[model samples]
Target: MPNLELLAPLAAALLAAGLFAGLLAGLLGVGGGIIMVPVLYYVFGLLGVDEAVRMHMSVGTSLAAMIPTSIRSALAHRKKGAVDEVMFRRWLPGIALGVLAGVLTAAFVKGPVLMTVFAVFALLVAVYMAFGKDSWRVASELPGRLGQTIMAFLIAAVSVMMGIGGGTFTVPTLTLFGYPIHKAVGTAAAIGVLIAIPGAIGFILGGLGEPGRPWGSLGFANVVGVLALIPTTLLAAPWGVALAHRLERRWLRLAFAFFLAATGIKMALSLLGA
Candidate 1:
């Protein structure tokens, strides 16, 4: 017997967030976890959920909501021949295992510790996106297949722990290894599916026996939020992928930089009581 009126505002928030998330996902190959995570943190705060559960819920919910959006966007990119299936096959195993480890770590970590880690990581990503080099193409690539495999492992591990789909690091890493921006983003989009599937499952498993969860939650995944968002995201993601094809490499890099900076500031502020 919840008040339907209150759900109106929550529904609106979810829709708006999902719309933006879809755009970001399609355009930049990001999973929108960075954006969704902080927003969910604040929203859950208002709902009086414990801070301990807030981050887990936010991360899990974002991963769940990202599934359809990523799928739609990936398909759009695939249609354009932008996705590198070979790269995806190389990275899948690592991303899957990494995401599981990440979810388990998040579930076990103390709340304050997790928040602090998240804040630091956010700041670093923002700074990297903002001031770091933007060559947009890596030449004289890293050694052999072995090097690439190691890189995949590291990227997956970090992405899972942070609840990101690995784009924040993946695109730049690829660029540094001689890949162009468009290919990097397209490949990253495809990799998102690999990350989300297992990450979502991990979240569900980790939260299954947790206590005092709100109704309408599926483990840590918020069913209400997911249902409200998936449709909007599915509809918007294709448009975003189309738009991504129109943007030049320079513009795309700048846009992603701005996004990372904004996400970082928002998270840092919340953590700092600002």
Candidate 2:
């Protein structure tokens, strides 16, 4: 067991992170993994986790937490009839396969390399969110079989690398293809569930036998983090869904963009050891 003195503060931090992550998931369809991964990295560092496995543990733990968070957010969206079940079904298989591939890759890749990739991708996502117009259309509707397979695989692979649910890419892709913003956000929440399940499992398998893991860890996923986060995330997610239904679309986009950009910058600065 961790020292009581240390564990108390860590629990508090995890709870706070969970609250914010849940809100982001419901409001932006982001699955909260983006926020959780970095937060976990810092927390694990404070606990003196080994540098070699810190990022891996963080990413894996984020994916595990997202399982429940995504489920809550998805159900909330489904209640509002915002989810597109058909699209989710169409994308599921490809995304699952991609996540498996990502797992294999992550098992061998070094931590710094993964962090750099995540930072760069996050920055690109921020740029697109900030400047990309809603009127942009890649197609009138979702692509056919070949295109769907390719895009879904790419989305899952990148999301796995970043320890994020697919929403960061999925919502934008859907919107670009002319889906309504609300519907896209809702659907993305559902997609998060798909990503989190396989993604978390992959991380667990990948991290098996790794040394210097925090106590109460199962593979790369930390039980302590998951336990601390899940309850708060479950409670907060519904509130965020409520807020999302009320917020204006433009304001939501701006807020999401700002958050992404800030996080991207923070990660980038870490690369420079700033």
> 146-261 in candidate 1: lDDT tens per residue?
66777777776666656667776787788787776678878888888777778888888888868756568888888877887787778778877888778654565566567656
Worst 10 residues of 1 by lDDT: 134-143
lDDT, candidate 2, 149-263, per-residue tens:
8888998998998899989899889898889989999999998888899889999988888998999899999999999989888888888889888876576667767877887
Global lDDT of each model?
0.74, 0.88
The segments of candidate 2 whose C-alpha lies over 4 angstroms from its true place after superposition are 249-256
Candidate with maximal lDDT: 2
Score residue 22 of candidate 2 by CA lDDT: 92
Report the number of backbone clashes for model 1. 1
- Give lDDT: candidate 2, residue 126: 78
Error of 1 at 171 (Å): 1.1
Q: What is the TM-score of each candidate against the true structure?
A: 0.89, 0.93
